[model samples]
Target: MNLRRLTYLGIAVCIASVPVLAVPAQPRSVEYRSPVDLVLLKNDTWLVVANQTSNSVSLLETKSGKILDEILCGDHPSAIVACLDGQHILVSCAHSGQISLIQVEGGKLNEIHTIDVGFEPTGLTVAPNGKTAYVGLVATGEVAELDLVQAKVARKFSVGAWPRYLTVSPNGERLAVGCSGESKIVIVDLIQGEIAYSSKLSGGINIGHLQCSADGKYVYFPWMIYRSNPINRDNIRRGWVLGSRIGRVRLDKQEYREAITLDVPGMAVADPHGIVMDSSNKRLVVSAAGSHDLLVYRRDDLPWEGVGGPGDLIDPKLMQDRDLFQRIDLGGRPMGIAMARDGRTVYVANYLKDAIQVVNIEDRSILRDIPLGQRPRPSQVRHGEELFYDARRSLDQWYSCHTCHYNGGVNSKAMDTWNDGSALTMKTVLPLEHLDRTGPWTWHGWQEDLHDAMHKSFTTTMQGRPASPREADAILAYLKTDRSPPNPFREKDGSLNESAIRGQKVFAGTEANCISCHNGPHFTDGEIHDVGLGSEEDEYQGYNTPSLTGIYRKVRFLHDGRAGSLEEVLSDYHSPEEVSGTRAMTESELADLISYLKSL
Candidate 1:
């Protein structure tokens, strides 16, 4: 369902099926164009895609890339999944905070039910039994467990902040939720309904799409590697600096060993997003969203070569038999990659272009340039969006704005932007939303206005030529529309729950004494505070009081990426400015406090 909807018409590719890894007679590439997630329906009969920008769901014939129907849905659809029954498609809309159950009867799609799950539903997965669906509630830091048969939310349980994606074990005994906000994955014991384990990955590890090995021994995900506390663009200029790594964590233990990596001395991959492995586990496919390419790897062909620096995710072997079989050009912003059940083709969702690029996996060529729908006309917002994802503007076409922001959101990594006119004092990348009011920009609060920051970001951070004032205006225009998503914990009537209501008292109360600095429409005063958090090595002691409006989406917090969770921010590293007795608060009280903070 994460794949997007189509327009009235679609572009068809070849209908011929190719066995796994077959080389097609023809070699070509094309894109239809658009957003969010891509999911191949059961039996390879239909391709269901979620379009966040278009507010619709697209269904297409498995073969020939033919459009079946496009169903209108709620706002900002995030994730989609085909039910175990093979007759239902679940679509999660972030802004609408609801799940639409599209019933597939007689090969036609129908919107059968719309159930309110929670706010900012970004990720989804279904239980093997086909009776349950787990949705990641981004705004509330919880997972709403829905009974598929009942078609209602059964319950909700707390997870890490901004849980973005879900992957279930083959045996159905364990579940891995990609905790994007925490830069880790929380494994839940399904039977026990408790956290079984957590893989605390390194910084900038935005586990975009997670897939369990066939044996379920490891969880494979695409990760960003920028190990130094503050990233060094010098390394990036050399090409080996930042790595888009494909990593595997042993489900049984904690380790950061690399099975594959997408960076080397030159021609680094930009943004690696959608990831999928064939049912045979023989092939691995990754969608490099920023670079607009699909890189396929043969598991048996993994090169023994090892790479070092900024933490090598390289295969440790010295031999250079690259496991990668082919790197096909997708020619658009590819978001999600979904493999068909027949193992012949992979469907790609190009987030910005409003089309799906179907690739013949065996031939290693794009067979069709299918358009689900036509994107809107020219506008400042759309132009800015194009500019944001345009890697051509970067030095040697290495990256784009989307490479760092990952669709206007944080990559959860500290950056050595060199904007401070200092070295090694890297600042974490800030969210682009509500920037008009969240200034002064940057962790150091150096730029009072965004206009000044744009020049610095281009010349200093990107290591490229300065952007024109007109170009900067267009980028800001698109960014201005990036407001905070709805809070999932709030009721339909816009009232907080009893626990959150009580927790609000702790937040604003004299006991906590937090309002003087955190007050205002966005829950921030737009000023700096020392908060007793300064280290001798730090350049400046005081840090900006950032808006809490979208705190739930943060992977790390504080001046640097120190606190991984709100609990850690409040209790383990409670600052002098925080509430009294926070460290000694009861578990129930902590939950209430967190609930209230997440609501904001």
Candidate 2:
């Protein structure tokens, strides 16, 4: 069979064929201004947006709402931050693993420097003195501190797993890093250059942008809490299964954290991304990316601690108070927010609409929608991408498909979505990179029909209205476009290293015997086997052989996430002696084998 290579976010993978409706591809010249993050630069006169898909940055005049200029940068620019000097801004190019520093010179953006940081640089922040900057390296699980003057990485310190965002305290003494994979907030003492506190968020996932208080007392962010209960209507309605929250971590102390539930009886917030506070600190705004709205809250009036007593996450009386909180609906997905100095006007990076919405908090209305630039016409794949991220598709607008499979990738947690025949059977979220080629969906290899599986996800797992046939086809089209990121373990020319090359021999040899069930280009035979890893609660006795293509991206392994590392998966649970009835590999052999697996 012939194969075609697909590349997204710098990662390339081979697929046998397109499985869904073939949408027309856009021209390479047409810019898709998927504005993910933005910041107010040049003293609020200019709004700078990080156009993710376009691989550029757009500088817009705040007053006239005109696109001043679009400057090309590194690939997949994810976040932008204005420097304290008011003349330069930094953009974190995620796919390129580089930070582009641009100077704001007389209404024009000039690329000054490109600092090669590390893999997946997502969040960025500058210190009070503007001398140093911090970047959250997602894949490396470390925070890289850059010396602004030197234009190079000064040092790196490990925070936690997948640090997606970072915030610096007002005093510039502490930097709070949000580690989404581990669901922990690591506070780095800038003065001492070490981790001061590591506050774990129980059941937290998808931790969003972080904003430190003016007084340097707390760091606030938006995140989702997963309750591993059966996917039933009662649990979903009561916000017991999956819910949203705005969490805070005390910077002055260790392991001190608190959160307020953003969900009410009927209405709930989902995929809360960007968060900001005004200069006066009276208003707090959070962009609900999944729900496509801006949640504005009165900062002082929020019931944080004394509302319903100890261990109370939500207060009914406070939730019913409309004056305390207001939701302003914006049609497109909102990822980042920039508050004006006036404290009422807010700018939102609307991803789907390819525009920035200027919202008025006092009147609770969208004042204007500033178009970033011209984009391609909407296709079935585009609509499918919208549906995949829209939380309104779920019951009570609680979660979207992206809530679990983040950006068509996997979340670090195993969830009991109840898609299988049994309940309470937690399974790791499988990545949708090559979903079209990987037939027989689900862990048990039970979902033979892809369209039926999509319908069941909406109807059963999400407990929402079943998708129409057309909608399902659109989703499938979007999934076909999804691809895994470039494996960092691979060489620059995409060749295996010496260790991996040696390990590849062992994999094909009988000692490891890994190629027996996993013997395809995608590394899966598409067959189910009794791996002896199933629990008694599992309805299905055998498990499907999963593809090991992007196994390096996964922090948790196995069907139920029991194996924390690839070494654990090979040495402890599914060892050669246990599965293939062979002798255990030596430590050197195991190390080489892991290196080879990561290269895939």
Candidate 3:
């Protein structure tokens, strides 16, 4: 028999042998009172850290190592940037979908205004003149230009899905945005009103918190290796996955397209974030979020460079000797980072521990821990989110749930975990949203309970301890609260537009019937169907129908990521009926249908 027949036979035999009630219950839950970004005051006296988990920003006195204040803000404050005025700060609150512009006068802050941007506004970059600011909207794949003069969003420009970080050129004319959701960087020309470049990166996932060089010559970010060829997890011990890396993009006219990759061969410095370079631009301080450690490396210290050059190289094994690498343990999940003017002290936002650990770059040692003033122990959702971003729960502190989810979202990469007894079969990272309403977890519909999936992830994927009963409840609470972000296709009145309404009728029709499988409030019928789509390594007779509420947010489509766009979703990969229906659909009608689906 062929592979398809074998797959059907295997599922039939397995179904006949096991019953639904036989599946065991598993406990789990997930948190970052997650500090996603930070900035230093112009005077350099205090550093402000955005606590996405706490909905607060903590001010730390650098000299005294004291928490001067923890000012309450909107929900999920992800990014903070110090404007040129020295008294103004722009903070992006992700959960609230607003950018709060706070004015600091004398010694206090004045809430100037909160401009409602869109869903999941992440990184922001202020112009040197402080006249304009650009905010990255993660969900809508657009960047909003905020005019500080008017205290409002001026214009929004499309970039890519999940524009996580924004870095402005020194001249303030060019903007480089790290589109993490799509694993690419989009360079926008501010004056011309167009994208100058959209460079696809290698092994860059959840790429955020970018820092430009002093001369504005390049941008550096921490990324991970997911393997190029289709491969199994068996080679994980051989560095096939969970590999450490630092990527650099040269922007000079001579080397505008040049890319550089650096790594310490065989080292387990996973989940790189919070990177800062010293004044001389030699010493580099990077927070390995997954390992709970800070890596200190000097560019000159690399042994690859010959006598007298910058050693422009791309060797992954230049720093193989462990003793040659200067590393420090932060003992917590570090996310945001800020460096002193002189570059002697580096401040780190320890998201999980609620403290700011200051590291002296000179000796690579922890100078002090400035408490953000810990609140009560994390509640269920809070605890769950912290657990979600934390790597300590994994074996040897290898990586955290954020390694795959990015920020309770998809990683835009595929992996073969052998979870379903399949080898050399890759599955795209499914998004975690509208979990409570969407029943039967995973694409195969193996785990009926979300908590059970969490337990399996911890025990199997992370190779760590199974989730406790309480932990499971906390994680589930977080999943429920982590609703799908507001889709951008809604009308001004928050109702379906005429095109979408028309397309809705088309969707319910028998020829282009989408409601049969994608039905109800969550847009899923909670059923599996053969649908004539199966591969050789697929162990299931059918695939679980997924929710389409935030379908526009996905960079790839289907379980194996065969479709790269929404238009492709209606193309050859679709079932015969859908293909025929879509083929007969007029270009305008097809556009309307797509617009309608995205509005969900």
Compare candidates 2 and 3 on TM-score and give the better one. 2
The CA-based lDDT of model 2 is what?
0.85
Instruction: Give Cα-based local distance difference scores for all models.
Output: 0.71, 0.85, 0.70
Query: Which window of 10 residues has the lowest lDDT sum in candidate 2?
Result: 1-10
Name the candidate, 1 or 2, with the larger lDDT value: 2
**How would you order the candidates by lDDT, starting with the best?**
2, 1, 3
lDDT tens string, model 2, 388-505? 9988999988899999999998998999988887899999999898898887789999889999999899989999999899999999999998445576677767899999998998
TM-score of each: 0.83, 0.93, 0.84
Mind giving the per-residue lDDT tens digits that candidate 3 earns over 413-500?
Answer: 7766555556667788777887877878678877786767878788777667888989888877877785455566786468999999
The TM-score that candidate 3 achieves is 0.84
